[model samples]
Target: MARITAGVGSSHVPLLGVAADTGKDADSYFGPIFEGYEWTRAWEREEKPDVVILVYNDHASAFDMKIIPTFAIGCGERYMPADEGWGPRAVPPVLGHPDLAWHIAQSLILDEFDMTIINEMEVDHGLTVPLTMMFGKPEAWPAKVIPLAVNVVTYPPPSGNRCWALGEAIARAVASFPEDLNVQIWGTGGMSHQLQSPRAGLINREWDNRFIDSLIGEGQEARQISHIEYLRETGTEGIEMVMWLVMRGALGARTRALHRHYHVPCSNTAIGHLVLLPDNGEQPGTDDDRALATT
Candidate 1:
């Protein structure tokens, strides 16, 4: 039986790269608060997952406000990096496992979970920043990634509960794969900080703490929290916390959190990291996890 061996979460703050490239110990800004990534690094090495289903919010990168899909699956062969204010980073284009992606899509649709199927797309900083932090470079991703893009920029986006349901759908999709593969699903972004509107730079430690705790403790139950409550209490952009639930939902009811970190003011963002290991005792990831589409 296929099982999730590891899971990771992180904030995809663009400012981190801006700071790093400018030659600053970027960690100093968030050092006091973000204690999650350091632990996640160790967990990544220990688990060594092969494929990671990365769940992240697109910041008007691939999908615009015009047409947004609550859940978008990448079924493309390659994804171009987006052009931020600066020119697009000259990193490797993201390659996809189209066959597995189609399998996941077909299974979810059959399960009554509809999703936007994307065959050609370009991922923005929201996806790459976290990858750079986790894999050390855009060209050297430790594992093949299945991009699960969520729309967080639009008003009245998918509810937190809806994101959780997507996670459950993803789990069923992966579990039903006929081929044998060990996979790790990653949920990136969020930990109580706002990046848009006048409330930008807002960091709510109280809310961040509550969210991280519930993610580890309550699991899917955390989805019960309403988006209105999150926006009112944690700030609108902080709604990205809903994306984190996707990771927790993929995890077993009980998991061993290997490490965690959090930091604030990481270049106009809150930086956070989390790592989880499935308690069932399996190797982190297998070759099948990285298999590309077999035509």
Candidate 2:
């Protein structure tokens, strides 16, 4: 049966994509940001999964004010990069795993998640930036991607607890699949950032680090964080962190933090990345340890 081998949490800052595409990632300013992912890039090459369920929020790319689904799953064969005002980034289209995606959509719907099933959608930076951060400038992404978009941009988005429950359902769904495939769940966006005025450029490093600690430690503390707390402490856009709970929930009861990188002021957003493997009594001297030693 197909099983989730790992979970990844990351911040999807659009400027990171720009820096990578324009060859500015190696420069002094952006180099550090890109450098943080070097370990992840190397670790991924060694432990690449067959499919990745990428959880991200659509930034008015596929859906507008007219329609918003609390949760949407892309079941299409391929997703083209969205042209967000400036033309689309020079990246290959994200190929989708229709069989697995459809199965997941069906399982979630049956599990009473009320997921919006989308056959076509243009993926924006929210979805693609994480891909670039992890996969680098590949001619084609190494693994098939299934876009799971959540509505974090609009008001009354799903609660952190609800997202966590959804992740559990996803795990159940994946475990039921008979295919012998390795799957990874990725939750993208947020380490506390606000894009609007009044409190624009808001970033709470202490809160972000604490949240990351809680997420990597017991996880229950992170899952119980309230929406108001995210707004008041982390800022409006910081609520995106709730999506990380979804990734955490899918990893089951215990997990080992393989690789974690945190950086501040990435285009006024805190860039956070974590690679977690389900703890099955495995030792810590994995590839992550080797990567960290060299870096």
Candidate 3:
């Protein structure tokens, strides 16, 4: 059976990709940021997943003001890198696991989590940047991908708790698949930084570190944290951290931290990364099980 082997949380900063592509990541200013992901690069080579269920927000690259789905799942055969103002990064196009993606979408809808099924779309920095950070400049991504996009661009996006719940459902969906495959779910974007409004470069290193601690040691408590609090404490854009909760929830209540990396001022953002594995050989709760029961 297909099993979710791990969960990863990371920040997807466009400038980080720019630095890496231009070879500035090795320079003094950006070296530390790239170095933060060094462990992850090595880890990936060791624990290669057959597929990555990437959870990220499209920064107006795929979905603009015209159409926005709170939850969109990519069921396409292939996805091209998007050109976000600057041309697209010279990365290999993403190969999607259409079969698994379609399965998850069908299961999610049946699980009562409305998901917008996308057949064709260009992936932006939100998705590609993290891939670059982990895999570096490769001929092609080593694993197949299932792009799961959540709408953080639109105000009042899905609640943190709701995202967490969705993760549980996704875990069940992945487990039901009969294919023999190792899967990893990644939640990308945010530590603490705002890239809009007058506070374009706001960051809170203290809060970012504290949040990481809470995530590693007190994940259940992290779910109760409201989005308003994230905005107030971290920054408006800091709300993106909620997506990490999705990755956490999918791994069940028990997990061991395999590795963690944190660094500040990755351009205007604070970069954070975590690699976690389920500690107990237990099946994650299902919709009927309801880790966070709906009343």
Best by TM-score: 2
User: lDDT (0-100) at residue 239 of candidate 2?
Assistant: 91
Every model's TM-score: 0.86, 0.96, 0.93
Question: What lDDT does model 3 reach?
Answer: 0.87
TM-score ranking, best first: 2, 3, 1
TM-score of 3: 0.93
Residue 97 displacement in candidate 1 (angstroms):
1.3
Once model 3 is optimally superposed onto the true structure by TM-score, how far is the C-alpha of residue 8 displaced, in angstroms?
A: 0.8
Q: Which is better, 1 or 3, measured by lDDT? A: 3
Q: Who wins the lDDT comparison?
A: 2
- Residue range 1-295, candidate 1, lDDT tens digits: 4556667777887765554445453356643432344445544666666667889988777777578898888987778888887978656777777877898899888988778998987888888777666654434666667899887778777777787787778888888777666788888877676668888777887777777767664345678888787787777777887888788777766656656666665666566677665555444466423221110
Superposed Cα deviation of residue 199, candidate 1 (Å): 3.4
Off by over 4 Å in 3: 281-295
Deviation in Å, model 2, residue 138 alpha carbon: 0.5
Give the Å shift of residue 231 in candidate 1.
0.8
| Model 3 Cα lDDT, one tens digit per residue, 1-295 | 9999889999998898889889898999989878878878887897889999999999998999999999999999999999998898899999999999999999999999999999999999999999998898899999999999999878978888898898999999999999999999999989888778877888888888777677664358778888788887788888888888889889887776767788767778888888777767445466322131110
- Give the residue spans of candidate 2 off by over 4 A: 282-295
